[model samples]
Target: MWKFTLRRILIMIPQIILLSILIFILAKMMPGDALTGMIDPNVSPERLEELREKLGWNDPWHIQYADWVGGLVQGDFGQSFRFKMPVTELIGERIVNSFWLSVATLIFTYLIAIPLGILSGRYNDSLLDQTITGYTYLGFATPLFIFALVMLWVFGFMLGWFPTSGSVSPGSEPGTFAYVMSKINHLILPAIAMALIATVNTVQYLRSEIIDTKQKDFILTARAKGASESRVYNRHILRNSLLPIAAFFGYEITFLIGGTIFVETIYNYPGMGLLFFESITLRDYSVVTAVVLLFGVAAILGALLSDIILSLVDPRIRIK
Candidate 1:
């Protein structure tokens, strides 16, 4: 397992470099530079040239890429053109809120999806199963932005049960239980909005996996051995059924992290997603690259974790 993890980490280095190159290309394709808006209409050509030189925009693409990579190796993500701050610092300022929000969404999504999925599978074709299936289908069909807007309107505007925007209320006291609770309160709508589609996908996948597992020869053999229905379900069916779900758990983290863009933007939450939106609008290449790299790393890590978990849960996987 340790060797596998190390190997995966080693593999990630090249993947990230390739992803960085792609991001650099996209950044170069943008119509203008960081100084495009900043330059005065009457500014002398020499002054503009000096500014470009100072910003290293005059460097060859390969040289710029090399410098960027060197800075990345030294733990510097470069400076954001729009924000005028180091990309690392800008991301650091926002990542914690996004991380916590994603965590909360993951917890809520699984807590709701798994048990309902189990019951739906256990009573396949029943009214309960049909109802859950319909609900999940609705979730899948709904657009995330539309759902976010509706949730904000219904819960925030109409009922006023939750705050409409931001990670927490202004002037929230730090290091207090009240502050924590306030943050959670502000998180409810966006988290739910983000998790809605994910929950449906999880439920649908688990239900399908469980149904197939219960029909397998192993399950039939367990039943023929005079195992009680509950025992067979708990000891055999459920355990086997969860292996795929467990593997998917890691990918779900990646999904939720990416999905946070809509939720955080709609809610005006101060997180990576919101920052991503703002950075893109302002053409902040450094920050945009940093954000993309962060998401890419997360996805690679998630996939690696999923493989490791699958191997652990099913010995056949490890042996193979």
Candidate 2:
């Protein structure tokens, strides 16, 4: 396991480097630039040239990339022109909010998906299975923004059951119960919006897995040995059936980040997703590069973690 892990890490080094290079190139190739923010209609050409030179925008792409990589190695992701702060500091604050949103969405997704999927799979061809299938189809078909809007209109505007936007109510004191409650209330709509999409995916995967696993020779053997159906399922089939779902768990981490952007934007929650959107609009290259690189790294890490979990769940993976 250790050898496999080490090898995976080694393999990721080149991949990460190539990904970073691509991110940098894309950022540079964008039509506008952060220097636009420094320009005024009255600003002279010479002043713009000076600003460009100061930012090393005058340098070749390779030189700029080398400098960027050097700073990245030293834990400096560069300064964000959009916020006039260090990119790391900006990311730090937003990533935490995004992480919590993702966590809540993940918990909600599994909590709803797994048991429902199990029921649907166990009672296949029954009313419960048909109902679950219909629900999953609806969930899959619903556009995230439309769902978010409906959530906002019903819960936020009409019923007033939940706050529509932001992580907390204004003037709510931090570290207090009211603040925490405010955060959760504000979180519900967006998290649900993100979770709904993922729930469909998990339910479909688990339902299929359960159906396939239950038909295996081993499951039949256990049944023939007089093991109760539930016992056979819980003790034998469940774990084996979960291997693919475990792999999806890793991909879901990155999926949540991408989803968070849309969800957070709709809810006006301050997180990395909203930040990415704002940075792109402002042509904040530093923030854009940093966010893209972070996303790339996250995706790679999630895949690697999934492989490790797959190995643990199925020892055959370790052999391969």
Candidate 3:
């Protein structure tokens, strides 16, 4: 396990390096200049040149990328063009919001998906199974932004049950329970949007695994031994069947980060998604590159964590 883990970490080094290079090239290739968003009509050409020089934008692309990579190694993510703050600080402030939203979405999806999947699998071909199948199809078919809009209209516009946007109510002091809960209230729409898209695939994967497990010889043996139905299903079947679901959970987390980009834009929530959107609009290369790298690291780490968990659970996955 240690060897495998070390190997995975080693592999990630080049992956990160490649991602950095790609982001650098992409940022450079983007049509607009970073200073385009910052410059005003009144700003003179000399002043703009001075600003570009100050930002090191006058340097060759390779030199800039090298400096950026070096600073990244030292934990300096560079300053944001839009916010005029360190990119790390900008990302840090928004990460918790994104993290909590993702957590909420995960909890919501898993709580509903696992049971629905189990029931669908256990009663395969029955009406209940058909119903779950229909639901899953509906979830998978609907686009995330559309779902978000519908949810916002129903929950926020018509019912007035939750706030439509923002992380927290403005002017609310941090660290207060009310403030935290209020932020969670704003999160509901986006969370549901995220969960709906995720739940469809999770249900399909889990249900397929459970149904397959049910037909295995060991399951038949357990039944022949006069094992209780619940024991056969939950203890033997679910225990083994959950391996795929466990793997899917990690993949789902990575997917959620990507989905959050669209969800956040629709709802105007202050998270990494919103930051990424803003960075693109403002041509904030530092912020854009930092966010891409951050998400890339998160995805790699999530996969690594999942592999470790799988190795622990299934003896077939040898340590070495």
Candidate 4:
């Protein structure tokens, strides 16, 4: 397992390099001068030219790329013109909120999705199974923004059960139970909206796994030994069915992080998603690149964690 993990991490080096290059290309494709993103808007041409000279803007493309990568290695993301602050500092603050929201969203996603999947699969074509199937399709079909809007309207305004936007109420007191509840309350609506959308894949995937595993020879052997239905389910069928779900978690995690951006935007929540959207609209290239890099890193880490989890749960996977 250790060897496999080390190999995977080693493999990630080239992927991260490729990701950085892709980000650089995308940033370069944006309209306007890169120098504009690094300077104050009201600066005179003289100052701009001075900065251009100082930063070696006249250097060859490869030299410039090397400089940028070197700066990145040293944790020196350029200043955000819009925020008037270091891009890393801005991302550092926002990423925490995104992390917590993602945690809440995944908690809701798996807790709700797993049970529905098992029930639907166990019951096969019964009414309960059909109902879950229909709902999963609805989730897959409904646009995220539309669903978020309706959730805001119905749950936020009509029922007044959740705060419509933001990470917490304006006056929320830190280090208090009320503050904690406020945070959780703010997360609930958006988390559920994202969860419902996220759960479709898990539910369908797990459901299919359960059904397929149920017909296997191993499952039959377990039953023939007079293993109780509950015992066979817990030990044989469900355990086997779960391996695929565990393996698929990396893809699900990447989707959740990416999808959270729109949900955060709609809710006006302070997170990487919202920050990424705002930075792009404001054309804050430094902040945009930082957020994109963090996102890529998050995706890579999520995949690595998924593999680790799969290996822990099934030794055969690690051995292979």
Candidate 5:
């Protein structure tokens, strides 16, 4: 297991490096540079050139990339042209908001998906199964941003049950119960948007896997041995069935991060997604590159974690 884990971690290094190269290239190839967006139309050409030089736009692409990567290694993510702050600081604040939203969405998704999937699988071809299937299709068909907007209208505008946007209510003291409750209220629309988007697909995938496992020879043997139905399903089938779902978890996390961009924007939640969006609109290359690299590293780590989890769950996967 140690050897497997070490190998997975080693593999992530090259993946992160390659992702950095791609992001750097894409940022450079964009139609404008940071200076282009920063300069006023009436600014003299000489002043614009001075600003460009100050921002290192005068350097060769390779030189700039090397400096950027070097700074990255030293934990200096540079400054955001738009926000006039260190990219790291901006991202750090947003990370908390994004983390809460993602964690809540994850918990909600699994809570609603796993048990419902298990039940649907156990009662396959029944009315309950069909109903779940229908709901899953509906979820799959709907666009997440649209769902967020509609939810905002119903829950925020019409019912006035939750705040329309933002991470907390204005003037709410931080770290108090009131502040926490305000955060939760702000999270409701986006969380529901994320949950409704994820639950259907995850439940359907789990349902299929569980159903397949239930029909396996080992499951039949367990049943024939006079095991209780719950025991057979939970102890035997669920354990084996989780392998595929576990493998997919890492990919799903990355997808959730990307999906959060749209949902966060729609709900006006201050998160990495919103920051990334603002960075791009303002041509804040440093912020863009840092956020992309951060997300890439997250994806690589997630994959490594998934591999370790799979090995822990089933010893057969351990490296020799």
Candidate 6:
């Protein structure tokens, strides 16, 4: 297990480098310089040139990449051109808020998906299975933003059961029970929105896994041994069936990251998703690069997490 984990960690090094280079190239391809949004519109050409020189914008891309990587190693993510603050400080709190939303979404996703999957898979061809299938199709057809707005409108505008915007309510002192409750209350709607968007594939994956695992020779053998159906499924089938779902979480991570941009924007929630949208609009390249890099790193780590989980569930993975 240690060897496998170490190898995977080692593999990430080159992936990160390549990902960085790709982002840099893409950033370079944008029409204007980062300085475009940093100054007054009427600034003189000479002033813009001077500012460009000061920021080493004229430097070779390789040199700039080196500087950026060096800064990353030293914990300096550069300054936000628009905000004029350290990138880390600008995004630190927002990342936490995003983390809360992402975690909540994933939790709810599994909570809803796993049970439905088990039920539909366990009782295949029944009314419940048909209902779950219909729900998945409906969920797959609805756009995430549409679902979010419906949730916002029905729950936020008409019903008045949940707050539609923001991660916390005003005048709730941080760290208090009221503040915590406010956060959760504000969280429920958006989290559910993203979770429903996230749950579709998980449900399908686990359902298929359960169905396939049920027919495996081992499951048949267990049943042949006169084990009760419950024992056969509980002790053997479920354990083997969940392995694929564990691996599927990698896709979930990327999905949630992408979904958050839409969800956060709709909810007006303060998080990296909204930040990414705002930064792109403002052409705040420093924040953009940071957020994109964070997202890429998340994807890479998510793959690693899947491997780790696979190792945990299937001892053969660790033994090899």
Report, for all candidates in order, the number of backbone clashes.
Answer: 0, 0, 1, 0, 0, 0
User: Each candidate: what lDDT?
Assistant: 0.86, 0.87, 0.87, 0.86, 0.85, 0.88
Per-residue lDDT tens digits for candidate 5, residues 1-320, read 78888888887888888899999999998888677754467888789899889878779988999999999889899988778889888999999999999888887887888888887887989999999999899988998888889999999999999898899999999989999999998987788778877888778988898889988999999999999998997798888776667766776678677878898888889999988888888888889989888888887887787778878877788778
Model 2 C-alpha lDDT per residue in residues 39-144, reported as the tens digit of each score: 4678887888898899899899999999999999999999987799999999999988888898899989888888988888778889999999999999889888
* Regions more than 4 Å wrong, model 4: 33-58, 311-320
Residues 43-102, model 6: lDDT tens digits: 888898998889988899899989998999998989987877899998897999999998
Off by over 4 Å in 1: 39-46, 318-320
Q: Give the CA lDDT, 0 to 100, for residue 314 in model 6.
A: 74
The collision pairs in model 5 are none
Candidate 3 structure quality by residue, lDDT tens digits, 1-320: 78877887888788878888998888888886777845578988788889889888889999999999999989999988679899989999999999999999999899888999998988999999999999999997888888888988898899998898898998989899998888888897789878977898888888899989999999999999999999998799898888667866667769887888988988999999999999998888789989988888888778877887777677578455
lDDT by residue (tens digit), candidate 1, 1-320: 66766776788789878988988878878887766766568887788789889888889988988888899889999888778788898999899999899988888888889998999999999999999999998998888889999999999999999998888888989999989999999887888888777889889888998899999999999999999999999998888887778888889878776688888999999999999899888878788878987888888888888888887776566532
Cα TM-score per model: 0.93, 0.95, 0.95, 0.90, 0.94, 0.93
lDDT top scorer: 6
lDDT of 4 by residue, 1-320 (tens): 89988888998889999998889778767885545655456888788889778867667766877888888989998878788888878888888888888888888999999999999989999999999999999998999889988998999999999998899888879999999999999999999989989999999999998999999999999899999999988998898888778877777779877788889999999998999999887777778887888789889988888888788777777744
- Model 5 lDDT at residue 285: 83
Candidates 1 and 3, the one with greater TM-score: 3
In order of lDDT, best first, we have 6, 2, 3, 1, 4, 5
lDDT of model 2 at residue 153? 88
- Judge candidate 6 at residue 316 and give its lDDT: 81
